[model samples]
Target chain A: MSCNIAIAGVTGAVGQEFLRILEERDFPFSSVKMLASARSHGKKLTFKGREYTVEEMTDKSFDGVDIALFSAGGSRSREFADAVKKAGAVMVDNSSAFRMDPDTPLVVPEVNPEAIKDHKGIIANPNCSTIIALVPIWPLHNANPVKRMVVSTYQAASGAGQAAMDELALQSKDILAGREARCEAFPYQIAFNLFCHNSDLKPNGYNEEEMKMVNETRKIFSCPDIAITCTCVRVPVMRAHSESINLEFDSPITADEVRELLSTAPGVTVLDDRENNRFPMPIDADGKDDVYVGHIRQDESIPDNRGINLWVCGDQIRKGAALNAVQIAERLV
Target chain B: MSCNIAIAGVTGAVGQEFLRILEERDFPFSSVKMLASARSHGKKLTFKGREYTVEEMTDKSFDGVDIALFSAGGSRSREFADAVKKAGAVMVDNSSAFRMDPDTPLVVPEVNPEAIKDHKGIIANPNCSTIIALVPIWPLHNANPVKRMVVSTYQAASGAGQAAMDELALQSKDILAGREARCEAFPYQIAFNLFCHNSDLKPNGYNEEEMKMVNETRKIFSCPDIAITCTCVRVPVMRAHSESINLEFDSPITADEVRELLSTAPGVTVLDDRENNRFPMPIDADGKDDVYVGHIRQDESIPDNRGINLWVCGDQIRKGAALNAVQIAERLV
Candidate 1:
């Protein structure tokens, strides 16, 4: 029996990736409905050799849908999420709207799949940087409970959505053409430069992206006291997000033991080995499904096995967003 | 009364910047001599309408020179630094060679100017990322002795030297021309991406860049036990190096207190104000002399005021490299 699936904010970046992953995975789906804001109504998207037109989302958008995936802005979900649950569809939200909600289960299938079963009609997909960081981190944290973490992310333009990607594309083209790059969609021109500032600034001095990493990590790990700090930056990279994570664990962590843990982990692929000059790069991880991790070892400066330094790279649009949501959907049946 | 000056590695990136800064700063000079490798012996450089020809660096390069600025690779200094000093020059070497040497003092003028009186003969310059991190951190560390630090750097092409910058420009032009980027200077194309790996991968899995930040900061602050861990990344930025530092101290730290400390710090320029989306960025810090710090706040996610997060940016070629060396030179007199 195929599942009747619904996608919320069907016109957004992560939502579109959700559709692509679902179709590519050949998910057991009998019917599909795409819902977006009023502006995107009548827009058509194709999935699994089938075409679906976008409908204006409302309180009744999830009626008769067995499962709903949401990637709309937080405000949209805050407004209509209950209506989605009332309509009998289990919602998987990719917004910050309900991520830290005590009732909401923020699920990274690789990290906390069991959390999916307790979802109150919504499973929260993590922030792109957080998702990428955990792909390498969770396995190690599981083997040796991570006591603290410090991460710095080199994120791409696509995380901001299609418009920011477009800005990067155009600004790159302009800079190459010897012209001053234009700025829109981002606070600055997205040429051959990177900045720690995100589009929106948070009141507490952390950018929205940085705050997401801090908050989402606590929820996914279920470790409220795990010290986490992040510096999130938007690089000129087109697709993938890369994170340099330093983990301080409560238990012993050797390179061999950590490698053994990761070798058996579901979503992580080790790429370390400095002799041949091998490590994961965003270019190598782009368009791939798995998170590529490398440079794994203990940070000697951190005193003991408390410091595990590693790097992670994955397509933010895919594993960090869409594919993760689809994997959660597959678990429902 | 003019200052006698001698520049080592006159053909290198930081060497070139040192020459530019000296001209721009209008430093008093009775006689100036340029020194480089045997290959660059005949090269003539025009600095502020004065023609200086490169001389082959030998034991006599520092004869009668009051201040000798060294930017050659580490080997040269390891071999000849003592001889240069014996010739009676206050040598400011920008290499990993003498930074950890016990007798040579490491100075960042702005952070530890009083340490200048302690230099025996050679004064070491800190790593680019360390300079940027300490520029903001030393002020806070001064307010309260920073017990531990975790830093991630978004470094620029110029820190890798002139050839790396040239490689970026050339590869960018090649990518624009629809040709495959030919990367000879870096392990990967540095146009639209980030490389999580550093050139100096060590047996302990920590890159030399990371080690420099750890060891150099300890030496500069004269705090041997200060805990430090760092991850260095090469970004697409041309000149500035940005650091995301998570500092843990013994006492309480507040955002207001951080602002007050940074505002009065000698080399620090505060650019933080969250409501207006204002913060330090590379585009603004490039070519500037001081380090720009922003996004200061208490990291409540950790226990106590044990955590404080900050973002800092400075021209790697300036404050991180040449200008800092010049600043040290100024204090030596």
Candidate 2:
């Protein structure tokens, strides 16, 4: 028996990525449904060489579906998660609405595949930056328990959704042609420019995007005591997210040990070629599934061998969100 | 009498910036001689609305010149610094050649203006990334001795020179038009991509750019014992360099105290507006002399407020190189 799948918000950036990933993996499916908001109704999308017309998502849309991948915003998930559950479908949500709910398991299949078995008809995907960062960290943490983590992210435009990605392209074109780059999806021009994440600021001066990273890592790791601080900045890249991470461990760990651990770890590719001065670039990780890890070195500032630094790049839309959700669905099967 | 100035490599990016900065500051000059490689000998460069023909730099170029500003790469500085000095000219060298020399003072006027008095004949300008990072750091270091510094830089194309900047513009247009981007001046496409600084990788795995930040910072701060580690990456920006700096202090220091100390610090402008999510961006710091400092927050990973993080942006050609060299000239005057 094959699973019957439904893709919510199928016309969006992550939603489109879900369709591509599903086809690339040759996911076993008896039937597929494409659903989106009314604005995208009657839109045509192709899956596995089969064209499917997009349907307006409603309470009854998930009937007879085995798994529904939701990439709609948080409010849409809040409105339809119960309906998907009542229709006997497992909802693998890519929204932030249910991620922090204790009842809903937040899963990254590589880091915590067992969490999928505990889901109560709905599982939440961790934030894109968090998923990309943890794919490398979880393996190292397994080798040596990290006492503290300092992360500074070079995030991409796709995190803000399809409109923002389009804005980057359009603004870049305009600016190159000597026209004033018009800002729409972002508060400022995103072409050849960077900014602090535009998320709402918290009382502690950390933006919401940064806070999500801090909170989501704890939830996925199931370790509430990990000391984490992050600075998230939106850069002008199209899709991939790059992070510079400083990890302080309780015990000393060498760069070679870290490399050996990650070499055997699932969903990680090592690119630490110091001789060639090559490390992970977001362009290299743009459409790849694995987290590109490199620039592994000892933090000289900390004389102890306990502090190590690394650079990571992963496609935010694929591995960070859509592919991760689809991987969780595979685990459920 | 006004100082007679000779600008070496006057046709290059930093050289042009030096001319603009001189005009903007209304610098007192008896005569301005523009000099470059033999290939640029006939090129005309305008300064203060008067066009000056670029001269092929030779040993005689520094004769009758009070201060010679050298920016024509390290080899040229090594070949010409002694001649300029022997010709009774003070060489404000902007190359890496003499920066680490014990007898040649590396000066960031705001951080170490007193060091200028000890310059035997040549005063070396610190690296652009180092200058930008140290402006705000020195004040904080003065307030509380920083035990460690961790720096990650998002550098601009101007650091590479005029050809690289032009390539960024050209590659960007080609990519937007669905054509393949041609890579030159850099090992990879730089229009929409970034890479580790192209400087030769050292035996310690740090690039020349990163080593400059480490070594030059030590010499300028007169704190050779302070621990420092840096990772420098070149982004797609046309000008200006931004750095993410994490400082570990011996004792706990509050974020409020950092803001207060930087508010009065020379060559620093605080842009920390958490409510509005406004912080320093390269676009905001482009063509500006003061290093823009913001994103000031206590790193929560290190409890007790021992770690403070900040972001800085400064015009590389201005404060990082040319303006800094000119400031040394002012000290000579």
Give the lDDT of residue B243 in candidate 2. 89
Q: List TM-score per model, in order.
A: 0.93, 0.98
- Quality of candidate 1's docking, in CAPRI categories? medium
Worst 10 residues of 2 chain A by lDDT: A295-304
* Each candidate: RMSD: 2.5, 1.4
| Candidate 2, true inter-chain contacts retained | 0.59
Q: Which stretches of candidate 1 lie over 4 Å from their true place?
A: A37-46, A50-63, A79-83, A197-203, A301-304, B38-41, B58-60, B79-83, B118-120, B176-178
In order, the TM-score of chain B in each prediction is 0.95, 0.98
Off by over 4 Å in 2: none
Which 10 consecutive residues of model 2 chain B have the lowest summed lDDT?
B189-198
- Estimate every model's Cα lDDT from 0 to 1: 0.84, 0.90
Instruction: Point to the candidate with the largest lDDT.
Output: 2
TM-score of 2: 0.98
